[model samples]
Target: MTRGERALLISVDAGSSVPPYEQLRGQLAEMIGDGRLPVGTRLPTVRQLAADLNLAANTVARAYRELESAGLLQTRGRHGTFVAPGRDDAMDRLHRVATDYAAEARRLGVPPAAALALVRAALDATRPG
Candidate 1:
């Protein structure tokens, strides 16, 4: 961890419908966008985040992987993860992408229940939605 990098056990509202992984992803994205976690800021390891929140390593890893794939973070071998430069714009882009996907799903005659089921499946299969 970087100097002064206080590892915060990011809080999650138990009553919220959002999954834990999504909460993690969104919070990190927001922090990055708002400069709370500045560009190139090193992040805690997956195990560290999992331990911090009492979550499974896979959960944190999935969120980190998605963020990395979305270009919001970059992982260095054995060094750790860091915020990716120019990733602030990705949060909005991801929202648009989800909207477009939902629209397309509706256009394909996918009923609301089935659509939600697909979303649930995707969320279960990958990171959070």
Candidate 2:
């Protein structure tokens, strides 16, 4: 097993209610959030991971795609995917915070317009006269 995989203990329960792709995605995201999978750490190829886990390649690919979409991973063509770097500067931090909030809003079923309006109102209320 790769150091990252060994540290994260990525696994899938075939009989669990959660889908394999989602299961893999959640574990990877958790590892990334907790720093087990550090930025620039290359991931195993989709085929390789699928074979190791006894899952279809598409399952691993879906997990990787979702992570990439959520800004947790980056694919460098032939080089492969790696954990994305975390934000270090103020604006970058704010952007990450906002992205997290937006994700929460989505999970809570808040409409996109409603979520934006709420943020706007909050900002307006906090603004100096």
Candidate 3:
């Protein structure tokens, strides 16, 4: 296993109510979001990862697809998968913070409008005149 794969330490909880794909997806997403998996880091191939984790290839693929849709991972044919690069550093940080905020709001059972209003109010308060 490479340094990146070892650092990944991803696992699927077979006994959990959550599906394996979701568990895998959540872990990988959190790692990418927190920079534990730095941008452009190469990911293990679906087959390889599946073998290592004792999961079906489809499960790993599904997780990868979901993460890709969420802008966390990108796949290049033959070359394999990698953590998606930030198009712009500042925007990337903002996007990560925004994603974190949205997740926390949802976890707290806050209404979407309320969460958005809070963000707007924060931006307004912080904006220079």
Candidate 4:
């Protein structure tokens, strides 16, 4: 399916306590996590998504930025944004688990750098020689 078709499945409730950008981000992330938005899938441009959702461009931009930072999406200059390639189910599980870990770390007042360091240590420890 096309990116616009995928995006059309998402909806925003302005009355919800959750912020609009977060709602968009979560929906996009869920789609990406599933096979619905497979690797290399091209996403709508920020302005295009904003217009479709009736949100300010910055709102969509912020959601895109967050997903990009999380390595779920990548921008290719004029080519536009696309879902980052990954190992399908394995990577999706990893992303979901890592997100949960990060949330737990945040709840426990762990600093971002320290949380990442801990994750790196765990990865190194688990890596095969």
Better of 2 and 4 by lDDT: 4
lDDT of 2 by residue, 6-116 (tens): 434788999965689977987787677666777888899999889889999999999999989878889999978888876355644565577588669868988768989
lDDT of 3: 0.83
Tell me the spans in candidate 4 whose CA falls farther than 4 Å from its real position. Answer: 1-7, 87-91, 97-129
RMSD of each: 8.4, 5.9, 5.5, 5.3
Q: Clashes in model 1: which pairs?
A: none
User: Residue 95 lDDT in model 2?
Assistant: 51
Error of 3 at 80 (Å): 0.5
Clashing pairs in 2: none
Steric collisions counted per model: 0, 0, 0, 0
Task: Write candidate 1's Cα lDDT for 32-96 as tens digits.
Answer: 65567777788888998888888889889988998898777898889888888765466756655
C-alpha lDDT of all candidate models, in order:
0.75, 0.80, 0.83, 0.83
Per-residue CA lDDT of candidate 4, range 9-123, in tens?
Answer: 7899999656899879977887788668877888988999898899999999999999998889999999889988755677789877876786687679887689889989988
> How well does candidate 3 match the true structure, expressed as C-alpha RMSD?
5.5
Residue 97 lDDT, candidate 1, scale 0-100: 64
Per-residue lDDT over 23-44 for candidate 3, one digit per residue giving the tens place of the 0 to 100 score: 7887787777777888888899
Ten contiguous residues with the weakest lDDT in model 3 = 1-10
How does each model score on TM-score? 0.64, 0.64, 0.67, 0.68
User: Which of 2 and 4 is the better model by TM-score?
Assistant: 4
User: How displaced is residue 68 in candidate 4, in Å?
Assistant: 0.3
**Candidate 1 vs candidate 2: which has greater TM-score?**
2
